[model samples]
Target: MQDLNPTGTLHIGASDLEYRMIGSAPADAPTLVMLHEGLGSAALWGDFPDRLAAATGCGVFVYSRAGYGASSPVTLPRRLDYMHVEALEVLPALLDAIGFRRGLLLGHSDGASIAAIYAGGVQDHRVQGVVMIAPHFIVEDISVASIAEIKAAYETTDLKSKLQRWHGDVDNAFYGWNSAWLDPKFRDWDIREYLAYIRVPVAILQGADDRYGTIRQIEIAREECYCPVDVTIMAGAGHSPHREAAGATLEAIVEFANAVLQGDEGARGRAA
Candidate 1:
């Protein structure tokens, strides 16, 4: 519902999903598709996306996932494959509908997992690269413990009201992500097997003090991803690097984007 100027809004699905797109560039400028965190939305990005779009000369786009911000709430119970379905089916359809054939992806937390799956499944050469911020390749006990704490905080504190400001309907964003994660059957979820199959370059960023997951998650990603891997860790940052250490996170990502945008511009540059 927010106007992002150059890149207009659109209702993209049967659910009337509304998204905010920012920046304008040549059709050839690499698109930067932003995927938000578990309880995040377009507004929750809090100028991070705009700063990123300005830093890199790429177009930026972000949307509230179903049940997040302005997007419609989930109509039914979600299965374990919810993330996979979003990556494999919804993302592809969204890109095709919006004319984003080639782009670099910037995904945080759960979103990072989706980007990895999409990059591996779709063998498009134009898919450039990925920058995963605090990604989870496998579930960790630390994460579970933190989730339990969060649930407790929600029950006994103002956490729900605080989140409700960002998401008008608190339960939609809260339970949709919370229940899906805490489900007993969800422990079997893992995306590591797809890392080795990812052909595009990947830059994995993690915080040394991340509360959601530990450094082990990024280590798992680096160990499994066969392509060129760049791992960065910000000492004092937590689950949200962009907010915790914006300068460092942006600096690192700008460097990565430059390399990705360089592409074939070195020798046989393909004009788009």
Candidate 2:
């Protein structure tokens, strides 16, 4: 297979997923696969992937799931277990289709939960570690409340127009994520059960003032995951740490990624 990094569309399952590669994927260095947030896309990630590749000297692969960015759209009335499907079916297929050798998964918000689920559900040895930013283990009332606010913003404010700049079909991107989270049945959705199965190292980054969820999400991982678990709580930061505290978040992730890729066990040390 060619080792060149390319930006293009991949035909996976019934959808055409959009992705871009940063840096080369050599045998020695592991790649970093970035999964975007609920309303986020590859373009929305901005220069984070580039900065990460330069900082950690690891290849970075970023993609937009179906219904976001330039990818194909999905049907309405998405299942409440949408994240589960993404983890079990779509994510694994994406890794295989991309010829993934060894890599770390970096995910944000909904992406983080999806990454955690994938790590626990799939026993793929190629996945050395995972970096979850603002992950949710179990649904919270605060999460539902904040999601409700976003839905209101989408309708009343220019949030939709702003998101349209990033997503190809803005409604597909917004409603697909919004409708599911706001669904009353989704409150019972929980992935903490999968935590025990995660054998690889896990690093969790969350903001101190996040409106979507509280630190209980992190506690679940520490209690359930037997593997090395590293946690970081950014001071004065909100839901999106990478965006709210970009410098600090980037530094931590770069350090952790380098350590994990180098097979350093002590990298599991916690930070605040």
Candidate 3:
């Protein structure tokens, strides 16, 4: 594996992915690999990565997938199984490329779903745990409605202009995610099977009033997962708890990371 620069573009498969490394390298400390939400990118994470690194004393790696941020653009009308492909194919290559040794997979929204799929599907031992924020196991009526609403907002409002600040191909990022979710066939998109296979501990941070998903997501996880499942429902927060309830969300994640990754030599060294 090649050494990761603090900030650089990694050429993975056909796409060039943008990434940022905060604090220690993977070899020196446990690395938290952060996967952004559907409309989010590395830059869109803002200072959360930096804060996570400082709090846990672990390396934080944030990256944009193929169609997001400064990464390469993807073809229009992405596959309905795009998240599955990303989890099974793309993420393994990314972890290997970054020389990921040990840590948690921290993801938000679509990113969270992808992380869960990888953990349950891939059997990668390097992934010590998973932190999922607003993950969707099955498409809900509310999910499709919210996505449709966002599509309208993106077209009529200045949402596209705002997103352009983070994405090189804003339309590609927006439409790729938006179009796939809004597709009628996507209603049957379910990943509950993946939950049954995840061997590591799982932490879910959810917003109580989230418009896109409901408490049933948490219920599904509880039903399917045999591994230890930790749930925190943030009362006032919405879909993006890391952004909406920054302090409490970080505290929950930090506490879980320290607990699950306590056996990691690098993590122990960092704490010392």
- Regions of candidate 1 where Cα sits further than 4 Å from its true position: 1-9, 25-28, 263-272
The TM-score of predicted model 3 comes to: 0.97
lDDT of 3 by residue, 173-218 (tens): 9999999999999999999999999999999999988999999999
In candidate 1, which residue pairs clash?
Answer: none
- Against the reference, the lDDT scores of all candidates come to 0.79, 0.88, 0.93
Model 2 ranges with Cα > 4 A deviation: 1-5, 26-28, 263-272
Cα RMSD, each candidate:
4.1, 3.3, 1.6
Superior by TM-score: candidate 2 or candidate 3: 3
lDDT (0-100) at residue 87 of candidate 1?
A: 88
- TM-score of candidate 1 versus the correct structure, residues matched by position: 0.91
Please give the lDDT score at residue 59 for candidate 2: 75
For lDDT, candidate 2 versus 3, the one ahead is: 3
Supply the global lDDT for candidate 3.
0.93
